[model samples]
Target: MRSEGLDLFAHGMIGLNQLKAGSLDSRNSLGAILGGGMDIQIWHGIYWRAFEADYVWAALHYSDVVSPSFPDLRRPYQNGVRLRTGLVFSYGEKKAAPMTAACSVQPTQVMVGEPVTATANVSNANPKHTLTYDWSSTGGKISGKGNTAAIDTNGVAGGDYTATAKISDPKTKHGGETSCSAKFTVKELPKNPPTLSLSANPTSVQTGGSVSLSGLSHQSGQRSGQWRQLDGECRHGFRKRQQRYAEYFRRPTRTDHRERKLF
Candidate 1:
C-alpha cells in the first residue's frame, strides 16, 4: 500500500488490491474483492482500474480430511485461488507559443557624417529564450547578439536607415521584437566651362582660292563643326577674295586645265 501510494504521488493515481481467502479443510476456496481504504494516495478519478490474480499451493486435503473422519469436501480451502492487480495511466499536456521578437533602430533622422545606433531589449521572456538581430527597418544590417550598438557614418550618408532585432527561445517558443531608424545628408560640387571666336574679312570667294583664317582656339565645347566656312566663321580678322569666270571657253562636254579667275 505504501508503494502504491508513492506510485500515486510520483505518477498521479493508482488502483491496488490484495486477495486472501480459503478455509482449513479438504479443498481450498477461491474469491476476490475491490477494496483499498482511503489510506491509498491514489486520487479519485475516472479509470478502468484493472484487476489482479495470484495462486499459492498448500497441503491441507489429506491432513484436515483424515483428522475429523473426512473434513467438509464442500470447502476447497487451499484448493482455491486468489488474484491481485493494479490500474494507472499517463497522458500529455497542451501546446505552447513560440519565442518571437523585433529589434528597433534609434534616431529616425540622420545626415552625412552622423552616428546611428540601435537596441535589442528583451520584450518578453518565459520558459527559455535568446536574442538575435533579424534586420533593420531601413533594410540596412543585422546584429548577432547584444542589447545596444553604435553605427558609424564614415562611408555612409544622405538616406534613411533602419535596424531590427529578434528575441526568441526555441525551447519555450516565444519572444519579443522591435526596430529603429536614422537619416543623413551629403553636399555636392558645381561646374564651370570657356568661349571661342572666328572671323574672315570678306563674305564670298572663288573655288580653290586661298582664304586667310583667324579665330580663338579654346577648349570650351566638346567638338567644332569649324569646316566649310559657315555663316558664323568670319567673326574676326580673316580675309577673302572675289571670284572670276571664263569667256569663250570649251563646250560643256570638254574638260579644261585652265584655272577660272576670280572677280
Candidate 2:
C-alpha cells in the first residue's frame, strides 16, 4: 500500500541563553509526507506492519538573540525521514462465493424397470472439504453416491417425475449448500399385441409360376417388426420395410403343386 498527504510538524530548540533564562521557543510547520509499507498476515484480520518509511519536507523559521544586543534570523526548508513497524488491525468480514448446482439425467424417458442415471454438477465448492449428496425423487427410488446417482424406475406409474439432489459442504455452516432437479418420463407397456395381415397376388398359381406376396403389421406404440419367411427357397426373395407404426414385407414365391405355410 501507498499513501501521500499533508502533515503537521512541531519544532523546538534550546540555546545556552535560553537555558540560563530557563525558557525555550517552539514553532509549528506544515509539511507533506509520502510513504509506503509492507504488511504480513499474522492471523485472520491481524497483520504485522513489517516496515514503513516516510519522506517529509517542511519550511521552518527561527530567530536567535544574545542579550538583546544583536539578533540573527533565518528561514529554511528541511527534509526528514520517519520509519515505523507495528501490528495492524483489520475490521469487518470477508464474503464467500455462493454455491450452485445443476442436475441432469441420461435417457430422459424410459420404460418401466429400466434404470435412469442422474448427475449433479456443482460450482464454488471448497476442494478441501468433504461434500455430501442427498438424493430424492417424486417417483421411484433414488440412490446417490457422490455427485452421481441411479434411479430405479420399477413399479413406477407412467408419468412425468423429478429427481433432485442436494449438495453440501460439511465443513461450512452457511452458504455452502445447494440443490438442483431434473425431469424424466416413464412409459408403460402396450396393452395389446400388434396386428398382422398377409395377402398374395394371383391366389392360384400353376407349376413353376411366381406369386407376389405382401404382409403388413400394425402396432399402437413405437415398436418395430421383423419379417422371416419359412420357405428356404423363397427366403432370398423377401424384402422388409420397417416403421415405428407399421411394417411391410414383400416376397415372390415359386410353387410346384406343394402346400406351403406362411407365418
Candidate 3:
C-alpha cells in the first residue's frame, strides 16, 4: 500500500515537472502570446496511450504524449522524457458592417428646374467606417450639380428630380440616395395677390376690418449648411484611420485638409 501511494505521488510529481519544462515557464515569459494555458490528460490510461490537451488561453488543442521513466531515478535515473504531438481543430468568424455615413437630399423628392441640394452628412466616429458620395440630374433641361464641393441648381427641366446619394465603406455594399431638389410647376405670376383695405360692414363698409397681402418669389439659392461631428469616442480603439471606398460613380469635389486635431 505504501509503495503504491509512493508510485502515485511519483506520477503526479513527474507530471508537474513535465508541465514546467514543457510550456508553463515558456508561456509566462510569452505573455505576448497569451499567458494562460493548461495541459490535461485528454485520454489517459489506455494501455500506455494518453492524449493530452493544451488549452492556450483561447484555443483548445490536443496532443498524443508519451512519458518514459526509470525505477532508479535517484539522480533521476535514465533520460526520462515526455513527448507531445499535435492534433487538429478549426475556428472562424463573420464580421459585420460598421456604420459608415449619413445623408440628406433637400426636397428629397422634387420636380425639375427650381433648385436642389444633396447634402451627404458623413461620420466615422465609431469603428471608422467610410463615407462617400455621387451626384446627378434627372431632367435634361436641368443641368447643375455639386456636393460638399459646390451645390448649384441653377437651371433644370420640370420633372420629379432625385439627387441619388449613396454612402458606404470599402468592404461591402451599403448605400442610400435622397433628394431635396426644389420642384417648380412654373406657375403664372400674380399681382400683389390683391391690396390693403379696411371695412367694418360687409356691404355697408364700416371702415374697421383690414386686409393686407404680399409675397416675393425667387431662388432661395442652392441649400446651405455646415458639417459637424455629433459624437466623439474611440471604443473599438481610437486610431488615425485612412479609409478608402469605391463608388459606381465619383464626383471631383472640394476637400480641405488642415492641422485640425480630431480626437
Best by TM-score: 2
Best by lDDT: 2
- lDDT at 263, model 1: 27
User: 1-263, model 1: which lDDT tens digit per residue?
Assistant: 32322332112222232333365332433333323322232443323334433344333234433456446532334333454455554345232343334445556555445555766555435523444444334433333446676665555535555454544344432223334333423321112222234455454566544455344433322222233434544422222321101111112311222222222
Candidate 1 regions with alpha-carbon error over 4 angstroms: 1-16, 20-92, 127-145, 166-263
Writing each residue's lDDT as its tens digit, candidate 2 over 144-168 gives 9999999999999999999999998
lDDT of 3 by residue, 20-114 (tens): 34542321111111111122222221112223322232111122232334323212212233434343222342232344444454554443334
Deviation from truth (RMSD, Å), model 3? 25.2
Global lDDT scores for all candidate models:
0.39, 0.68, 0.30
TM-score against native, each model: 0.31, 0.54, 0.29
Model 2 ranges off by over 4 Å: 1-94, 222-263
Which residues of candidate 3, in runs, are more than 4 Å off? Answer: 1-94, 98-103, 107-115, 121-126, 139-151, 171-263
lDDT value, candidate 1, whole model: 0.39
